[model samples]
Target: MRIGIRPARVVALLVLVIVIPLSVTSVAGRFMGDRVYLLNSTPCRVVVMEQHDGHEANPGETVLIKSGFVDRTPTMMVFSGSAFWFGGLHFTTDTLQVRDQADIAIPPSWLSSSIMGKELTYELTADGQLLVKGPTMQPSMPQPKGLPLKARATPDSKQCRRG
Candidate 1:
């Protein structure tokens, strides 16, 4: 015995098989493509150092300061982030004069002049905890006489772990 289907039925089945899977695959691809992920979870290093007197920081400026580790490499610091959401580490010093231009400007500086060239290093973890080594002070190159301070965060700093 032999069975045969009409040409019209065969064409309908072919269309259904091709069109349905294509539509489903396209939808799934779009859903997955919308998301972004950073593979390596290593923490980013951060440092907050003393700013020159009369320096004004704007809304979005990133600064590099020395690291507390023995290597004393330069690290990035921002006014706002996991560690310094309200304000990061604070220090005070007599040799160096620093100012806080934020809403609350303290006459005495939180970061000391001693840390002028030194880098106060911290590790920003994925969980929002800032891990900092003991504050280390180093002599830093002299900053130009006049420069306005600014608050800025790096690309990695801006991303928080997805819940």
Candidate 2:
């Protein structure tokens, strides 16, 4: 007769009961939000080139942070932008103005981690190129001084997806 259960069996059971559920829960959490943090490792100025969707203010602009990234320079930067999703990376996102910028414009996120609070660092070459630890996406620095204004509505949707 078995005392209770073998140690190996117990371990396996624990993994199935606890570890597996935890893993599944974590993975599923990604859908909770599309937040992200972008860091710049470039020497030159980084700038947002394009953004596709999720703008509540301007339908024409596509995103509010396109012109928001703070001096995406090589020296060092992090997104500080905010959005309906991602944090305006400690660096920037779309609108480097207002309160910096962030987004559902999902970026290359960290492992086992939800897209939320994901820190995606990038590097820029001397000639204006891009680099990163994994898949890359973010804004550049020194975006015009103030936020670009449009007559339609206003600089809304720091939450952007420049995809």
Candidate 3:
């Protein structure tokens, strides 16, 4: 005798198969993505040679994060996902400078470990150790600077990275 397959049962099974994994993935991503922040303390804008996976943003280029006017509302670059999470992103540390001020040189070790400060999604793992999560949306602010970065040759006398 052939077994009768109920439509409702098939739908339920399909929902369980699709919805469960999606919900789990979403929840895991929300808690597993480390937050990367770059707070610009100076009055002048801070420019970073940023490397991001999205070609629409910058690809592997520079971005100018507007300077913070007041301490209460500081301008910052809050990047997550492979952009700031992955420590091996070499193209990112290529440049860090303040307009009409000074350039900051990043050490190889720092670059390898990622200069951007991170808030662990889970305390148990290293920053960017798990990238099951990536940035879901691009915010209105922090758009990549349209103009190309100007060359700076002055002594990299300023320290830009701070905890």
Candidate 4:
């Protein structure tokens, strides 16, 4: 058999093969990308706290926290004018204290790990507010002093309600 080489035919064949696949892939990717899919079904827990000093909080202000961990306990504290909100698994020896002047707010949606060893500790002012001090990761010093309140008083009070 005798074969003749044609540059034009070879080029056309290569273009057709490459372009067809590329076009198909691009279209498929676009369609698939728009369809939202859950990559994983693992559950996550989140806790949030907001605190203010003797100064009252303004309306329409909101605080949020997002957490993701395979096997870890989380704790949060919120302080309002002389109040505080605390949630999550905390050790008994862990101190639950806050500044007296600060207010606290912990949302009802806050969650703690159900694991047996998990413990949550919280301290609040008489108005049921959280008294948070220092950094969220590690707060070394106590917050400024305000009027002391009981954590039980305003267990479910919203942040806007702290007057």
State the C-alpha lDDT per candidate.
0.32, 0.32, 0.29, 0.32
Local lDDT at 115 for model 1: 24
TM-score to true structure, per model: 0.20, 0.25, 0.25, 0.20
Give Cα distance to truth, residue 75, candidate 4, Å: 0.5
Encode model 4's per-residue lDDT on 1-163: one tens digit a residue.
1344577678889889998888776555423321111111111111233232121222322221211211221343433344443333221212322334333333222212233222222333334443432223453444434323334325334433535
Question: 52-145, model 1: which lDDT tens digit per residue?
Answer: 3211222232232322321322222333335442233232111112235332222222232332232222233334333332223534432222
RMSD of each: 19.9, 16.4, 17.2, 17.8
Among all windows of ten consecutive residues in candidate 3, which has the lowest summed lDDT? Answer: 120-129
* Residues forming the 10-long window of minimal summed lDDT in candidate 1: 32-41
Global CA lDDT computed for model 1: 0.32
lDDT tens per residue, model 3, 1-163: 2345677778899889999888876555333332322332222223333343221122222222221111111222222321332122212232333334344333332221224322211010122121111123422222123212322221121322232
In model 2, which runs have C-alpha deviations exceeding 4 angstroms?
Answer: 1-5, 30-32, 39-41, 44-163
**What is the lDDT for 125 in model 2?**
28
User: lDDT value for candidate 3?
Assistant: 0.29
